[model samples]
Target: MMHNATYMGSVSSVSSSSIIIELAESMGSGIVIIEGKNYRIGQVGSFIKIPIGYNQLYGVTSESNESSTHDVEIIESRSRRWIRVELIGEMIGGEFDRGISEYPSIGDDAHIVVDRDLKQIFGQPTAGQFTIGKLSSSDGIDVSLDLDRLVTRHSAILGSTGSGKSTSTASIIRSIVTNNDDVRLPSARILLIDIHGEYESALGDIAKVFSVLPDSKNPLYIPYWCISPENLIDFLCGNISEAYKTLYLDKAIEEKKKAIKTNNIKDFPTESVTTSTPLPYRIKNIWHELYYDDTVTWKEKEHINAAYAKDGEGDAENLIPPKFLPPATSSNPPFKGGNNLVKRQLEQMKSRLLDSQYSFLLKPGPWTPDKDGKIEKDLDQLLADWLGHDQPITILDLSGMPSSRLSLLLGSILDILFESSIWGKNLKTGMRNRPLLVVLEEAHRYLSKKEDGLAKQMVQRIAKEGRKFGIGAMVVSQRPSEIDETILSQCGTIIALRINNATDRGIVKSAMSEGLAGIIDSLPVLRTGEAIIVGESAKLPTRCRISLLPPNKYPNSRDPAVTASWTQDRTPENYEALVSAWRNQEITKEEK
Candidate 1:
């Protein structure tokens, strides 16, 4: 017989997975001692063992009522005195396997799981086992997930602010890439999108950081020509009609044909090239030509020549508009036949080109092209800069970037990598051979359900088809409710932290499999760093406390110490420096 300490009650009733246990009246104590340790009775998310014949059925208590339960967020019910257990797996022939061949009889004995059973269930970490944390119910038990499935199938980390979402993310990633005597994965490729610039302090040691306003060895640059012309139109010419958009795209294709021939790209189908092809062309040159066409005047009824006021050729290099002769209202001669259809849009494009804040995208260093469509460097060099490093991780710090166009920029980055993956699938250097993990932090900023931005489209594409190309995405956000349902549903693993909002809780709950969502009720009250990990990567639905990252390795995401800042004595203000940093649109080296 098992230890008397393990006795909880007998199964009073049984359903397919949910079993109602009638608490043992003889054992009235709410806390029972087993092997010198006290285990709470019917604690939600704690494991329970039901013994029937030779199989030991293991289940997690989803709903349990106790008179003496007390916690930070209490959900105890006095009217309901029942313990509902959801069977998870079974132990047969000393091996743990999910599902059972036989069901537990109504009068079968239910035991509060002890250390021995937990150790059997969790097991020791082996190769491919990534330890996330200790089980919340049994701290001594380490909860590990299958690392292969996690990186291949995709995952999400979600929670409210200050709930330790970023910390847990940094910890899990660090655990994967951390070098030690036991393991050394120097080739592991993790690309983290640091939307708020919060991960550098946590992951800098193991990662190579790139930023638009760089304070490191790497300065981020995204070539404008690499952007899909449709996305470019959205950013440069907002609220444009479809007819103008088509014309704009056709112009880009024309420019691309010239670029492909001049750049001598090998085997490229210049004949079939569309606006989506990544071709290097001078954006200013295109803008100037388009504007000229819109505002040009004709000399005669034949529309031949010399309608320009005098030497009025605009400088495409300088974005100078030519002086044009006014169109005659009663046309015969000096008739300016220029349509002026896209004059406003061309001006807007020129303005964006002139803005210094967008220079990183417009006049990207090395990748920028001249009027002749020649560049100092090409996409190969740009990709090498991002991926060909000794470190296992690459952090794209997007803190100082324009949030208004974040979707287009992010989409361009993914498009570059995805297209490379597609074209290079047969090569040894492709993502299929080495694999890539893209971690999108603060994903809701661009992946909102309401917006149909390019970022969302590429993410959806990756979510649906990226696995075959060895590209995986991890969408981290505080608000799961606002994320697109299609993207959220495609995630195979969900690492949900404490979410206080009921609607957010519902989103997390719905993400879990129907059988496992029962324990998600405890989500709202989870302590910081505690999470319920479920799905393809998890061995079982486990309520685990995530391991704390090294103090120095925690993400720079802690709440401001308002009380301390208020209590401190006044210091000299530096509004001048503050204004300078704001105006320059950069986080300077000193501040970094």
Candidate 2:
């Protein structure tokens, strides 16, 4: 028996399965010890305790009472006035009967127990890990991850503006990297896709930062040729036209190179080469020529051919050469040019391909023709750097990728990881036992139910089947309502911070157990860093104060207050000088 158990309080009031308990003089924040045993009285989250009969009753804490115990201020909201504690589990004889019931009625002498079997419920997290905090007033509990889970499970930190979601995420990452013994987490694989370029200083030192712009120390190169052909078409053509799509598919069939059974020329002749295997080719030019170019035409029930415009330096034959059909064919003649339409189209494509914005899309690497298809050297290198390397953390800095192409870029990463882990054949021998944890940040934008987008497909698959193949996905999103319900529901553990939106709150409530649903209703009023954690990972839902992380763990999203910043008489002149030089001076391109 613990010392706090001696101060047990009895039920003083009862109504509708709710019990009101008179607080002991020594009761305080979080847990109160009574009669030599520890018991929870109030939590960071709000709830109310209800009293029923038979020494057991249902009670829940609504919120923490802010008024000093000596000077009580009258507050209208019941959640603010009374500490809510839900009846979860009770010790019955030698066995533990989980979940509280048999409401203790008025005048029932029930021992006040707050820290009821906490050790058994939350047991310490795996070695090399520590419990930072537990969800307040919810049936499910979430533990702030250190290096052990973060590196192994891959995590995404997401939230809306001012949600403290970024702070929480950065804090967790910082904890892992800083606290490891012997720097055990040095190779922890971490890839941060900075959407707004906010996490530069937060992780710059320990982890190498890569971006498209030259501002960062380590720059990323998205070679144009490295992007998958399908991804290239999607990026170049937005919501492709029906005619263009049909023609593109038709072209895909015609250009396919068949497999060669024998390298010997005597066994397979050039003229007799069959078209069965898909071949490596550029879809950007092919799609552009077929849809926008007039010189490249398909005859009615006749073979198609490309032609050069008359204004092309009079080298029309050189510009458009006969392909596929041999020169010896009797019916095949050079296609006649209708106008300069094809030349204009080709020029447009060439211009776009050369543009600065599409530079990353056009020049990826050399594409080699393989029996399977065209293999990009850049993608192979990237994969080798990410997975083949034994290092635990791989930080893929995607800040430089064009905003329009971000979805496809992220989708490709997910596809690669999933295909490599699940489809690869080495399970029986247990040789290739590498389990990957893919963390998708800002998941709501790409995995929204409204779009049913590609990210949603890949994430959904990972959520459903990735776990079996040693793959786990952590989706961090502020707007839970906007995310696909299937993916959200599939998450075994949920770490929710302060969410004020009614719809978002409701979505969280729907996925949790009935006991936890009641707890999520109070999420809007939670303080910064205070969250309601619920899931399989916790014992009984507990209200725990998350320990403060080191300064390096601070997220970049926190903005300096405008009022305070303006109050200073003199400010730094870096931004002002840059703008002035660009506008007034004939600045050299490099200087600007």
Candidate 3:
């Protein structure tokens, strides 16, 4: 059926499932015709299959020659070029006949087969979608990801410090926002939690940049005071107090009773309230009131006139007079509890609440609590502001905040989105249709392999099950080994750039399917901007030069060569004068 089946090479090298076919002579044609089909068998991403024994061996045409010599790295042995693959499995029975034998000698016959079908493997997404990578070889080096994958599935652009990871992330995001035709995701919701505030200028055009204190012009407003009390405590204090805990549970029960009463449900218990309820706003309000509002305390009105003063020294602690107590209790009771444990707990809670930084959180304005410790504002509005807003990109710049709470803050936001999306089912009625993608930069700082952070938990859930619910996570980190294996293993696609660390390389190896191990071994040597893509989303794992992102739109990641600049003989003499001139211009304008 097909001709030109030349004896190009032989199986000079063999592994478990494949052999390296060394060409008798080198052939340098850019395009190779194999099995009656023309394929662009160029460098990096191209592959060819040759008959080995009973099974066929697959190899990417890494080196092609016009003469008789060439080198091909084996991918897999198959009957057809199309690799309908699962994962690693055992090879069954096979034997070599006289016609197919000879064990691939130096001059044995070998021919390139048709290019592996990528479109068939991954299938075309929507019309506007662009392919990212593919799962082709064992190395898990070549794969494709769609715009849908980049935006919705959540992606992490991870690599070492000098690996051009940021540029790769920017390039992919830009392609999604700018390149698509039919299905422009103009309203696509993306939140980049900027830890170092590095991406404001880079992603300004496509994203809403949020910055801190001095950069007040950025409209990112996360009112810490507005976060519900229970979440606030979990985020800031790490744990809640016993008395405040009791108060919080009481508030929740009371709120529940009110809701039931309004709906005309008669039976409601007055006692046995516990602090483990899911009603966030009610608990938040109780914490707020107990910690703040010195005016509400009976001790505030203690008679400090001459009667409370002893030896001209006033005791603020024991100065609570009869007039300051509640009317019925003060008139009837002498002493009940041996020691005021509840009172002591309340005092401690009050002190923590009254501190300047914490005070703001206790009674944050616009999200104030009612007299009965109920939040006045609705939670739906908060949800909409978070995910359903008009802007596609929302940057939660945490530059001003202390690093200690960064992980918790990020985690709370993630938890809210994930829980709401999964439990909030009806799109036609409530908040369900739009899915959120959270890109965690510097993930190692929060999510690690050994320790569990809230971000890691939610991220793992999204990675494993978010697709069904329209939620996904992308973990971007410099240290991949520091991240949890469960999350990394669940990733449907991986875009591994140049990695130098042996430990990091080992971790990547562990995550990939076994057949692709050799491809990954070449990782440390990969050039900048070159990557190996592998996963279910790709047709074949092929090494290819990723298209470079535009300089203006890219992150400011490249370090300057200071030594080269210093070595230059010529230097600008008017550098100080230039600065003075700019200062003079500013002074003149202010004088005018």
Candidate 4:
């Protein structure tokens, strides 16, 4: 057993969840060697123990300071060093559990926690635990997380740029998906929304990669008809008056009804259909009908609607006469008015149709309708392609997509998943039976509080109620301050890397427990790949150095070597290929 010589201080004050200790003069400001073992004294985020009879209480040192009493005799004056520690847990009968049944009284002895006590506090690796990293103070002690709370209760990973955020994310995902004898979580399903396509190369062998370019065998496509009416309008029409919106909705419903009748799909009731219904309809046909209403003219005398303006003799109006004949004049005029309300909408629709960048949504193979207003494929095929794959991880690579359409695209994808999970809750393949973890990278771009886009709404919904339905979200971002407070608060566990900005640190600190203020203050100085984990999934609030992955397993997020690139000779052939890629809107020629 450890002796009283190892004791460094006595508790000066006690609270419900914290204790303040005044250090002894002999153990001030540096490492204290006890029994030839070097033990660091009174550091922020380090642990200390207080023994009260048979039970021992563990706490993390949150703040440390040295102060002197104001005395006139300066030669005889002395300073006292003290540390403020937040109580983490208590150990009884050699087993550690979070929460304290009894608080240590003032003047109780405080000792530095050693390796044996740390092993007991962290507990042994079991079936439900996965290693995240090693303890910061003791490099040899591994830190593990409970997988159950990590997935079902939700989590977040936040850091600054170049702080190993992506690498840590990849490590956590790899640990969960990799088949191991000790960890029993082998059948997990994870969906990763890769905003920059940095993860495909890192996890491709173990995951199924999907992209808009269709360069891979398994291409990704989100049919236009699968999106909600609100998002569709946001994509196709920038903005419109309420009157025009009503007109558009009526036409959309008419088109959807025509498609249902043509395809002979009776699963849905015809009378209950709305504009937001997920059904295939001919987009071209709707445009044609709207254009005709906007531009078609009629003969004034006949008072009959005509596809084209005609002359008094019922002949097509001739602007010019045959060679050498007198030029035609407008004797009987065409109708002076037409429905021009949809002119701007028609122009926007035309532009989107001609742009190849939107082909993934508008020109999805077999999902697009033919001239006869019928589709060869349905929503089931699209869902199967996204979620029914044999691989445990599915990566949706959005690097090739247009930046302007990112908000709409993200919202539509999440809506599809949310709706599917709700409807298929009872099925064997549903989310309830086989839970899903949807990882959203660069979440701040779409999930900001200033915007109420569909992506934000769906993510907020999943964060609030997803646990009961077996749906969990893992939000990854570099800016925690920009993320929605409601969504961030819903996360039961937080893995924070080095955050340097004051505003960002303040936001993160506000979300954490009050006792951990000192740990929060240490965010700016954390080393790369080191993180402070707190909340439900962790045994306690811990500062750990995340294990470094092999070069091959690291994410593709390294900065380019500036000097090396500048020194290399430039080739005309390389420039030509680069221009070709720029013109084609693709990353490489092979994507074509």
Candidate 5:
């Protein structure tokens, strides 16, 4: 071993996975000069080496404190500093591997690890690995993640606002798509759920973006019938009586079966049609039938006055029918009590149908059902445009959607993709052959534990069972505390950026391995675009500064210059345009 005079400390306590280091009394200052190179003593999150025979054990300093164990009566005695380190891995026979085979004994010399030792531990980037950035301690050494484990086991990227979370996410994705040659993962399929419509401009060159309103070249559509019955009812009707729900389900099933038979859809099993079945049916027809049942009043056959009046009134426009409105006189005939139980639901449906904001779902081009309950397009065509595309990345932009229904819409999208993957797993073009990675941006919005909505449930299911079916999820969020704990715990890897909130940091800490819990305390002080990665994907817990990208390739999440804007002259045209966009519930004229 190369000898130097930069020794800082010696191991005072030994454990299977950690060791406590007592600083040398001769080291007066925390800084040391070795071979004309200056190195800091004990910095948390930094690496330390313990050499025993031909094997060298590596650890990261997690905690450090000044000690006063000696008697206070000795005024001339100086206080010593001690560091607590968590053993990460070991290097044996000049080969670095994760996990220690031998533990260091007390009195072992602990020295700071330099670039050469880091290079050996990190190893060279090979197939199935992509470099994210350089190590924070040593810029020369790069940090690479295992792509196979990253997708199959699942991962998460979390940080507070303005901490460069979006840029880090974009950089990671860009690396995956651009470094395919080095990683040997050319056919990577990634679906990004863009909540703010920011990634399109950043990754537009390599990604195919689909939005509520797309340009002429790219058609965007999400068929309403594609939504499961439970989600559909939740969106259209806030609340309804049990009897009304049963009636709705029966009508929906009847309509779906009829449409299947009429269209001769061999792919769908007509006899097994259920409320949750994906067969296309006319929503308008269901509404019309329900309206007829809710408002109509029955009359006795012996009531000749009512029968003659009905015939005479049919020819006159002024006469009102009992089917169209509630009866004015209750004593006129023995009739069923007013069955206006679905009045609120019908009203809600009418409002949703008329809202142009929902045109993408309700009036999807070619996917819309006609009066005869026939559609020009099918789910297969939609899936081809989304997953079976030439591009490796597909961005589903949901910025124009209403916030109130965003969770439901997201749930529908996940359901469609997951359900398709399950049924088509054995096929040549199924997800088993082409595994998918779904990146959910702002995941906390829909995955909070407070509500048991469809989005949360579907995401949870994907986290649990998706790996077996060739599906993976990358949950990106700023508020980790608010996200579902079950989903967070399921992630095998977590890329944590600078999180300042104590609650958020605590949540991340709990999800991470106990050995790495001490490193999480440095989260609040991490630089922008720098993160500490832990779990299956990373060989060892590492702090890395994400490589920078060009301005054009950066995500469009830069904060607006308030001071600069205020210095400029105000314009009426700008305000007018903003008002127009707001009133139209759209970002551009194409959406309107």
Candidate 6:
């Protein structure tokens, strides 16, 4: 029993954590069977066990080379040559752990790791474990990840398009909150940033969907005042003078103070109030005042008589600019009032205000402030509508959003949640008490290194301090190379699916442990849905197939079958609905 059929080779050389094993010439079969199960020899990522006393050190086969050319199969040919192994972990007193307690000397016998050995290494399922999928080599065994480390340390899921990346993402989260085996985790909070609005049907049964173009009762509203005034000012007013900027912010603060007093918000920390505070202030009213101040004309030097058109004072609610009289050519009566001409900047701001595409931000329902900065409902209800729902997940669908503002809106959403967590750290409703997992789909769009958007800034903050605050980010993208290195490195666990692009594969390679180059090398040929999981969350580097979601549960990102569709009977050519959908930036039932 000491040297059973599992024995394969002997260590010929040792250098630190790396070792070279010389295959035994007696075993040229290239296959070993244990309990009627076949195990291939000299396969990369396969485990090799070395024993010294009661402790057993394990190493994974990383590379294999033959001494002479042969015509036989690659697996058979490599069985007669030496193989390189990277030291992974050890088993002592029936317990499996990472890192070796003792190094195996040269000439130590190394045996193939079998089913029982894998069980010792992976261990039985436990409360701290979350099963993502099963081991590829061994179907009966599961590959469970360390849930606490996976979340607290942050994680990334990367792969090329059509590699089952989105499906894998949906499946992974589904595993967490799925109620099975008498287990119930109703408090599991996962906030998915569905950039393309693809997750509504994927996780609808288990997730609450909030869309900018709400098809249901839950209308997604992000009041402009909820974001920092400094950021919002830039988007609202193109480029205002520093003096005008100050005046605008002052007006905002005044309105906020008035709101605090009028609403009678008790025990408020007024001293900490700044232009950055998330407080309600009517945007239309602010824009109206600024426009009038910049362009108003006075009939006299004392400004006793105002120059107004026959239309009276313009409606601020409708963004009607108060018609003003032109400045007098003779420098009398209507003069260019002492105010500076901010026509260019204010004009830009007015165009933004008038665009219907930005209604979610400009005229947020319920949270929108009246002319007096009084709101129909406060921020508390907005938070509850997003986080305090019956489902374990909340999907914010931003498919209807314009790409130009994607970064700003996404970043503002993150800022809101992260700030909430920071302020309510000790409270039961805070992120610390009930941790939140924020899943960012198509992360490269906003997190790219070349862009300096608000999304990048807020993501950097969350990546650095979120662990301590019980907030986790899962960045999902096809192009990992485009993501900022700082942000990518912060992710302790990386689930790399099949990557065909060399640059993308290289980026994924660099993000993983340097010792697993052999495993990373196998990326290009991996089957769709297969992934290599490594880093702090994984006790051992694992290559396994991600559990597949049901067809109905798949994300709405599937490519249309061109061949199958073309072969079908042609329907009446009616592009009216298509044009209308494109013009409206929406998917009508007919178009869908």
TM-score of each: 0.93, 0.67, 0.65, 0.90, 0.90, 0.94
Worst 10 residues of 4 by lDDT: 315-324
The regions of model 2 sitting more than 4 angstroms off are 1-120, 128-130, 133-160, 176-182, 185-188, 205-208, 214-231, 239-243, 250-280, 283-293, 296-352, 365-378, 425-432, 568-592
lDDT of 1 at 179: 35
Q: How many backbone clashes does candidate 1 have?
A: 0
Clashes per candidate, residues 3 or more apart or on different chains = 0, 72, 39, 0, 0, 0
Instruction: State the lDDT of candidate 4 residue by residue for 87-134, as single tens digits.
Output: 988899998888899999978999989887888889776788888789
lDDT of 1 by residue, 30-85 (tens): 78877789888877787889887788999888776633334201323323245778
What ranges in model 3 sit over 4 Å off? Answer: 1-46, 50-128, 131-144, 147-155, 180-183, 211-247, 252-365, 368-377, 428-432, 556-592
Quote the lDDT for 590 in model 3.
22
Question: How much is the lDDT of residue 103 in candidate 1?
Answer: 81
Write the number of the candidate with greater lDDT, choosing between 2 and 6.
6
**For model 6, what is the error of residue 421's alpha carbon versus the real structure, in angstroms, after optimal superposition?**
0.6
TM-score of model 1 (CA atoms): 0.93
Higher-scoring candidate on lDDT, 2 or 4: 4
Model 3: per-residue Cα lDDT at residue 164 = 74
- Stretch of 10 with least lDDT, candidate 3: 79-88
Which segments of model 4 are wrong by more than 4 Å? 34-36, 66-78, 179-186, 300-304, 309-333, 569-574, 589-592
Q: Which residue pairs overlap in candidate 5's backbone?
A: none
Error of 2 at 112 (Å): 3.8
User: Candidate 6 — which pairs collide?
Assistant: none
Over 4 Å off in model 1, which ranges?
1-3, 65-81, 179-183, 214-216, 329-332, 515-518, 589-592
Q: After superposition, how far is residue 383 of candidate 5 from its true place, in Å?
A: 1.2
Global CA lDDT of candidate 5, please? Answer: 0.81
- By TM-score, the candidates rank as 6, 1, 5, 4, 2, 3
